[model samples]
Target: MPRRVAMILALLLCSGCSSELRNIELQRVAKDWSLVIRASQIIPVYPLTEDLQPGDTFLVQRPIDKQHELYDERGFLPLENLIHRVNPRGYQAFYENSLGLGGDAQPIPKRWLTNQQPWTQAPIASFPTYSFSVRSGSGFSLALPVQGVPIGLSLLGSDAAQGTITIADARTYGVDTVSLAKDVEDWAAQQRGFLRNYASTGAHPNYLRVVSRVYLAGRLNVSLQSSDSSGATASGGAPKPVELVTTAGGPGPQDASLEAYKSNLAKLNELIEKSLEKTPTGSGQALLPGGTVKVVAASARAISLVETFSRPLVVGYLGFDMLIGPGGTLGPPIPTYAVLTAQLEPHPATVALELLDTAGLRHTYEVLTKLGRRGDTRAADLVKQLDGLGTLVPRQYPCNMFHFGDAAGPLSIQHPAGTALPDQKGFVRITLYLGKLQSSIDDLERAQADKSLKIATFDTRDAAVDAYLAGELAASRTALRDMYRSLQAHGDLLAQAQEHATQATRKLLLE
Candidate 1:
């Protein structure tokens, strides 16, 4: 019983990248203005808390010695490795600006910034910083106790604005970025050649840009003020005027069809929800130390193709397999199992079935059908003999998960095979279906088909065989068709969402 597997190495829902405007306006200061990017008085601090006061200065920098490189992008890099500190007089100006006093604790609720995420926390996942003070509370600062890292910073300069610095929050790589610059000049120049190309091209074409081996991802833009002889800015002075950028929605031609599509999609989701409600739910225990990781890859199929078994199994007893299979080489019409992801509802009981999908599945079925009809009627006996070989024939196969976390990297996401009928009819039927499916898949691969389609499901659901066992071909046929329909119903779910999003994006574009 080979189970389908989907693998992801990082966070979920990262559907490509796009540039976004940060709300953070730097240098909006009154006293002792060094033009720092502090927590905003208009909005609560990330990981919003009381002890960690508002207006906490965000001092982002790498260690005194490290340089930007791929090795430095590790997300688990300690917060202390980077810098997150508030000044001694961090909130002095903010207090007077607001209806408050110096050092008086003010929790950010309605009285504070309660807007959407104003800025992205690039290269850094939002982590809690504990509050502490020194020098009798003058240099009170928020200390990064754990769970965040600062990658390198980007510098954008204009001939118009100098001697004015700023920093905005953003997320890139959904992990840490560490580029240690000796000074501001050094930082902005970390990837100057590539960064310049980034702005000129206005397209971050790839998921990564290798700058001195530091994998720069998306949404990273930091500004620099005037620097001194030492290539650093003075800590004290009247901060220069900060730059401003406004957010606006661009106009688009009316797309009533897209709007209608959205409305229909909403209804489809409702229908899917009701249908999925009848499917059994399943979960796998993550190995100790690290729990199950989240899935991020977007898949296309709704129905499951793997047969469920009562027997337990550890997927990837072999090696880590990827979710996305071969490209045009495998041909058009992605494998149904490949399109069927864990993220889908009623997670059909989920990868790239490379040899399994493209070669093995087809060949296995072809040989089986040929044998079964070889006049010797040896097909049934051959399959029974294989199935009879105990675990060697394998009702279930072991597989690996895509690993990235510190936890036990080998956590299995599938349940073991359950009870099976003595007759092996379910297994026999699956081979025949797979045999038929292999030809279609091969034909598509050879044609390099542009569209995906499914005619038969290879899911070996043992319970359904009860209908066949009772000599009810019509009932079995109906059951098979229902499963296929269910698979389509579920699989179309991803399509509906992608369609709605794609169309809605037409609105986001500034006409």
Candidate 2:
């Protein structure tokens, strides 16, 4: 009887232990659920390459520019080609400087420089090279002539102790003749002209002279050392002084004068336009000039624009379709491109998101599914319909099927009808949103994990349970808001997709 009583006691103890374990499990689950809810409140969204706000005006260049003269004509020549040629050189230099690489060395981060087409590796060939030096004095002066014209004169690298540099437009200064002599004689003649002008007029006028000066911090007893015209000492005993080297002609074709160069460019453009006019319109075959034609035209335009206006004109290449409908009932794709140059202003409603790869989208869909299972009915319904989102659209040029977000699979819109042409615009826009959603979902899961650890420290089961329940309530509110936002974004994507499909069908019929 005593042994039987002991066995009963043992059984009772085991049962109590089992109950405690079950309670602990329940508390853990509650805490985890609460953490997940809190995490859902803040989802990390992808940032845009160029952040934009409302009322921003950005310059966009697209291949959609019609080949027809009626649609292509403009008062000012498009500097697209010139910008392309010159910008690459400037970009190379800027990037090299940024990476601390010197003199045509490749950057360490080569991936950033890689593009669909191989980059041209040739160096700039036509610019004139120059070198100069200054002696220790109150000021100094130098003049460089290119093609018989003094294009630039400055005191850019002069030292205060070495004085300043003065420039006199020889023609305006009543000095009609500039000696091409290779010695200090030419410099002496310039100095005499300056003296004669000063003696004749009490003050120099803007058209006559341009002078720059820098004051020294401390006075020094020094005399002007005799040197050759090259700013090098005749004695040749002193250490070689640092020389300031500059190049003229920039990255494009050279001319005797900027004005002449501009005139030549205008003529060239007129000729090209005339040639294009002769071609059959709407043939999709606009005649581009041969032998670096685009490069020459682009460089000329870019140089002229910058020199004349001092404002940069940004340009880029874009590819998209222009669809026309029979009754004009068809909707056009959003008149926006992936690349934009805009003057931005603050607008809370404007947001841009990018998903560079596929994995990001899949992760987003998984998170949405989790949220759906956790009592988000809207999310649940949307998730169910995601698979049937987009229809395949046919392309005319290359003649192949195009899929949206296929790179980021499963969550991507599967082409609904085999006969239907994919809406390229819808495909691109929806793909972008899918990437954004995926990124946010991934963030939610990470946040939940972090919160779970904090809730785990509760010593009492009742305390854990209370915290978990409180977390759930807070999370539920946020989840509901997120669900609505997701639905809205998805709805827009669907609407655009339908519009794109309709446009495609109309375009095919018209064709």
Candidate 3:
């Protein structure tokens, strides 16, 4: 095993040194279904397909927000400059990596890519501001330049012919590797003998880390299908076909698209809600427009629904993010695993506003919680501003009904039983924890409902919201506590996974 690790490192480390390399593939990584270089040989011949010299308006093909179609920008990666050339078509010609959906289903034209527009008008520079932690590769692209590096450990030969992707979620989302070099030093301390030798740890992780930022941040496989009736597929799936990969990815998609599921989820939710709110519909299905929606039978508080589109609406198979390592083979992807876990931390000032906007209430909550904790005796004039500090208005939209990507697996055969989600649900307890959280939510709602009658000053529940700022401010502490505990748990899980991988690899070698 040690010898093999060394061999892999030696082959990749010889940057200017030539060693025979097998057929290699280049890939583009992003969140949604974007473009990628399919399996191909990575030949280093100049001017492969197009003469896209640096600054020659080369559509390197990636995304970025602010008039950019998908917040992806690939110009920073100068493949043309790096290698003289090889087969240029694969590099220059980007193909639909996803099972074509809402967007286009063709190879993005050079013009289309060069003139990509943002989802909204005006460059939303606000996005690029946030510094990312290594929870998943969120701001990894930004993190790369510091190291002069999706960290391409994300694309191209970051895999060689090496197509391997387990999402490499190292579980440790705590330590921010803003100065990933420092992160390497720190990680070096924790690593065992063979890997500790950063001097030869496969060039200390290659560039795929960049492409992964583009292709995968977390989780897998979101399939969209509808069913006005059953025969959606020949399999005649189990009761609730769409089980949720409730782990890995973000807290699911948060936008208008989710509202489409609400009505259908409502049909099922009503059944559960109606049965005194503790009911299960005996694995019921709601025949709604465009599809047959069903709730995987579970207790009322822990609801997950799936909508099978009437027709098989597969935009594209995720195809795959193949990363062939040295010697043109496959195994648990090494080197990059550490790279994936560690992320560069962004400036708080940069991210605080953005996080507060689309992502987290934690940023806003932090200020209030701090004030509440310190119990600062400020000058009297500021008391009014302090009082309303706790009224955090979360992005209000679908209060319920979420689409947890798609059930990940060999077509998660019918969730007639709440069967599949992801191979590894973060912390194992995240799903269970949701139930406890729901209980807390239920308790809060009940308490608020009971107290509704006493407050007559303001019609909306308990007086004007300003009246509860102090109380809300105090609540931030609890909210922060939950977020902290959750993050900590994920960190611990990552450690365990790392150790487990080591042991398993050793076992495999022995066998």
Q: Which candidate has the highest TM-score of all? A: 1
Which digits, one per residue and each the tens of the lDDT, describe model 1 over residues 70-90?
Answer: 112221112122112212232
Off by over 4 Å in 3: 1-178, 189-232, 235-265, 268-511
Per-residue lDDT of model 3, residues 119-232, tens digit only:
111111110111122211223222121110111121111221111121111110111112222223222222223222211122222111211111111111111112111111
Q: Which stretches of candidate 1 lie over 4 Å from their true place?
A: 1-126, 130-322, 325-352, 364-428, 435-511
Model 3 error, position 64 (Å): 27
Better TM-score candidate (2, 3): 2
Better of 2 and 3 by lDDT: 2
Model 2 TM-score, all chains together: 0.18
lDDT of each: 0.23, 0.26, 0.24
| Model 2 agreement with the true structure over 226-264: per-residue lDDT tens digits | 232222111111111111222344555554466655565
**Please, what is the TM-score per model?**
0.19, 0.18, 0.16
C-alpha lDDT (0 to 100) for residue 483 of candidate 3: 39
